[model samples]
Each structure stands twice: as C-alpha cells, then as structure tokens.
Target: MLLAAAVCPHPPLLVPALTGAQDGPPTGPAAEAATAAADLRATCLAAVRDLLATAGPDADVVVVGTGPTPGSAAPDAVGSLSGYGADVTLGLARVTDVPPTGLPSLPLSITIGLWLLREAGYDGPARARVVTQHATPAECADLGARLAAFPALTVLLVMGDGSARRDEKAPGALDERALPFDTAAAEALADADTAALAALDPDLAHDLLATGRAPWQILAGAVEADGRPWKSELRSSDAPYGVGYLVAVWTPA
Candidate 1:
C-alpha cells in the first residue's frame, strides 16, 4: 500500500549546479530567478524527505515521472544532468562508485527523482517508472493500481510540471487558459482530491502544455486502489520562470 507521496517539478534548474552561477555573485533578473529557484529546490527537498520519512527504513520507494516512453529501472540505475550542461550524476544507491551496467541512462524526470532521494539521504530500495506523455488516463490508472499492490511499505516521488505556458515569458509563451488549468490542478493536489485528479482532461492538459496530468492521474489511481483516507499539504505553488511548479505531500489520515 502507498504510505506517502510527494509531487515535485523536474526543472533542471532545481540543481544548483545548473543555475549558471559564476564564481562570484549574480546580478539583475538572473539573481532574482536564481533565488526563487533555490527556494523552490529547498521546499522540494523538504517535501521529499518528509515523504520518505513516513515509511519504514527498509520500505520500498517508487519514483513516477513523465517520459518519452513507459519503462522501469532498478533503484541503482545511473543518471546524469550533463545534457543540461551540468556534470552531476546521481543514482538510487548511496555509493556513487557502483560501476555502470550498460543500462540506458534515466530520463530527466527520473534523474531529478533520484537526485531528490539522494539529497534527502534516503537509503531505502527505490525504483523508477516513467510513463509516456501520450499515455491515456486509463493506462495511467492501470499502472497506479498495479503499484498499489506492492507488499512492503511503498512511497512515491512523482515528478512533472504544470503548464509551461503561464505567461509571455513562459517556455510555451502566453496562454490565456493556462492559469485556470494550473489553478485547478493545484487545488486538486492540495486537497488530495483523487476524484478531481482522476477527472483531469488530457486533451486540455496537452493543449496547455501541462506535463503533470498523466502522472497526477496515476497518483489518483494509486490513492483509489489503496482505499485509504489521505491528507495533503500544499507546500508551494508558483510560476517561477513562467512554469507552474507545485510541491505537495500526501499521507494517510
């Protein structure tokens, strides 16, 4: 059964190393944005830590995120942020010296998930499952139901971002409808409203460039299958850099 869960955005800038900071101080808008990103990163780290703490030391963890395809990887799988111009590499294991096993490097979402686990000093067994953006709501629900069957205490770290078209400066540029969509999503997450989350419109989400729809729907399915009363806390919700990033934690009631 699901013990706890954390939802976080997977922006590459969450990593300090990818913020493009120089040896000295930063200036102008870059400084302001950097500070905001730092704050968001800290909140995300805290949420992840709290989520993992809800489970036993030996409990299993499942990291769910959006990717180009659906796949799973072992907890010890390796991932790198070099593609984002950062040299940081992370894995689910504590020891960084584990030799590579010729497996494909994890996608950006799982990479961020692994980074969060390591940052939070989580030593428990954990694996990553990536669901494609194109996955239907039913498909995501099916995946979540299966995850709910894990015998041991299980926690989930879900990584994905809300609308990227919140403003003119957003990655996808201004979209008048983006704010309402993201606002509703934030409310659903904050209230732990499984039904509302499960009812999210995939077509509208795709149009708004919200990548968190599928993953959030999967989480809703997991919650439904677990059949437990749950409570939630919304840690942060903002459009930093014009992308709607939200952080929240869900635990049994």
Candidate 2:
C-alpha cells in the first residue's frame, strides 16, 4: 500500500553548495536567485520530511524520477554530484569512503532525490526508479501501480520539474502554452486529481519541455491504486530562471 508522497523539482542548484548559498547572504542581482533557490530547497526538504513522518517506520522509501531511460537502483549504488560541478558526495548508500567513480553512475534525477533524502537524515532502506519522459500516461500509471505493491508500506519521493518554457529567458523560450500547462499541472498535483493527471497530454508536455509529466502521472497512479482518498498541499508553485518548478505533497486522507 502507498502511504505518503512528496513532489519536488530536480534542479542541480537545489544543492546549496552549487549556488554558493552556504557561503553567506547574497547581495544585489544574485539575491533573487539565491533566495528562490533557498526557498525551493527548504520546501523540498520539508516535503521529504513530511512524507517520511507520515509513512510508518517500516515503510519502504522509494524515489521515483524522470530520466532518459527507464531503470531502477538499490541503496547500495553510489552517486556523485561532480557533474553538477559540486564536490559533494550523495551518500544515499551511506558508504562515505567509496570513491564516487568506483561505482556506476546513478541517474541525475535519482541523484537529486538521494541528496534530499540524505539531507533529511533518512538512513533507511531506499530504492530508486526512473521513468522515461516519453512514457505515455497509461504507461506511467501502470508503473505507479506496480511501485505501490511493495510488501511493506511505501512512500515515494517524486522528483521532476514542470515546464522549462515560461518566459523569454526560459530554456525553450517563452511559449504561450507553457504557463497554462504548468498551471494545470500545479492544480492537479495540489488537488491530488488522478483523473486530471491521467489526462495530461504527452505531446503538449513535450513541446513545453515539462519533465514532470511522467513522474507526476506515476504519483497519481500510485495513489489511485491504493484506493484511498488523498489530501494534498501545493507548497510552492513558481518559475524561477524561466523554468516551472512546483513543490507538493500527497497523503492518504
């Protein structure tokens, strides 16, 4: 059965070290970026904590995120943030002494999820699953149902970002549909509306560069499979650096 779930963005800047947010307070033009990064990071951490708290002690923690290919990883797998230009080791495996390159690379999305779990001090059994962005809504939902069948109760930390084209400066540049697309996604997640999620248009999402579509659909599938009325909160909904990033939580009501 599914317990609680959290949704967070997978931007590398969430690592404070990357943004120099750990150095000290920022001034001038950098302040806005720093502050938004801080807020997103804090909310992501809290959402992780919230889901963990609601999920019983023995519940299995699984991080589901989008990637170029579909796959899964065990906690023993090692991960590194060197690709993000950060020296930090994402020790989800809890093996600090192992050189990062000693193990095959964990997917970038999963690495971000592990970083959040590690920061929240989640020293328990954890797993990672990756769903390719091109997956159809039906495919994502089917995978979600399977994810919920863990022998023990389960909690999912879903990591993926919304549209990347919200403004003139966006990676995909401003698209008229970006805002509406992200807005609908935010509302569906905030409301735990499985039907709405299941109805998301994959082709449209692809156009706007919304990576969260597959992961979010998976989340909805998990809850629907559990057959429970769920409650949700939209913690953060905004586009910083022109990319849509939404933070949210879902729990069996």
Candidate lDDT values, in order: 0.86, 0.86
Q: Candidate 1 — what's its lDDT? A: 0.86
Off by over 4 Å in 1: 21-24, 74-76, 93-96, 99-104
RMSD of every candidate to native, in Å, equals 1.7, 1.7
Q: Mind giving the per-residue lDDT tens digits that candidate 1 earns over 130-193?
A: 8988888898888999889888778999998999999999989999999999999999999999
Off by over 4 Å in 2: 91-101
Per-candidate TM-score against the hidden true structure: 0.94, 0.94
lDDT of 2 at 219: 91
- Note the residue pairs that clash in candidate 2: none
lDDT of 2: 0.86
